[model samples]
Target: MSDVPPIWYEFRDAVYCGEFQVAEKMLRETPSLLHMANGIGETALHFLAVEDDQRGVDWLRTKGFNIDTKNEFGTPVLFEVAQLGYKELCAWFIENGADLTAQDRDGRDIGEYLLYYDKSEMADWVRKLGA
Candidate 1:
């Protein structure tokens, strides 16, 4: 078993719960754990995607986390936000220089994948971002 620190688990849970302040504290105290993922290969950003917390996303970006980082299943931050139809978050991510053309494990581009998943609005948003 890998000897991951307790703060790593706390950070993941905090992220999933949208507790940005706690997550930030944990991250600041243990910067090395910022890149750690949870049981499903979800990094802090993946949890933030579900939380849809723009503030947390901005904080993470400021902390130097890679916006385009993918989980083990190859799902990028944009993919998750798009799937959830979070237009503002998706637009923010695009403005911050996320790769619009990145593909997932199935080799589907972000736009195509969103449409395939019946997220037409998000697919349209992706198109608007020039994906």
Candidate 2:
């Protein structure tokens, strides 16, 4: 009998299974689900990051979801996509108000984190956004 919220699991599954349509419908129907996090504070955005589904991410943005929220570990959603090297996603995050200067609990800033891992393409894109 897992006591985790069903919506959170459903939201995560929708992203994991690449069902953006379902996710979109649910979010539109229940906006607060956007703020629903599990025991670890991971929302549907985190699942999107894990899936690397650009469309799902874009849908979330179109719905006015804030991508800058920090996770349970104090890491912003930017950190989730940092290693993926999705140039478009990274750029979109910056354009949509994601904080490049956000530091995680480990004290690593997002731009630095991108460069430290040699994600030059993404690093270059972020650098153009200024310090």
Candidate 3:
């Protein structure tokens, strides 16, 4: 069996399935898991963004989750959502003061990365935001 903890899988599954209640319960039980990483190196906040779970994202932020944190690939929270065409999530971060021009390790800004992912429309929008 994998040495990974059982709660780890539970949390990941909860986020994957959009079971915010289950995820919240797990966080309530073991609050530190909020910032803990899964096997693939995604924190609970990352999953929340991936799912566009606004409530979960807000709850995590209230718990002190760093919105500026990077994933295993050095993708920031804002960039991750923007690349997914999550306009609401992108606007939330941008309006809330995320660096508009923050680049990944490869030096690709948000617009460039969106274009790289073939999200031409999103790239245009991000560029319009001057990010």
TM-score of each: 0.83, 0.74, 0.76
**Runs off by more than 4 Å, candidate 1:** 1-5, 12-25
lDDT of each: 0.79, 0.74, 0.77
Model number with the top TM-score: 1
The runs of at least 3 residues in candidate 2 whose Cα sits more than 4 Å from the true structure, single-residue gaps closed, are 1-3, 15-25, 115-125, 129-131
For model 1, how does the per-residue alpha-carbon lDDT over 1-131 read when each residue is reduced to its tens digit? Answer: 64556676677677666687887788878887668776666667667766788877777788777889888788887898889888888889889999987999899999889888888877886797888
Q: What is the lDDT of residue 36 in candidate 2?
A: 80
Backbone clash count, each prediction separately? 0, 0, 0
Q: Model 3 clash pairs?
A: none
Task: Give per-residue CA lDDT, model 3, range 1-131, as digits (tens).
Answer: 66557887787677567687887788889987866876556677777788887666766677667777677788887888987888988787777677876788788888878888888999889777778
* Model 1, residue 97: C-alpha shift (Å): 0.7
* Winning candidate number (lDDT): 1
TM-score of 1: 0.83
Clashes of 3: 0
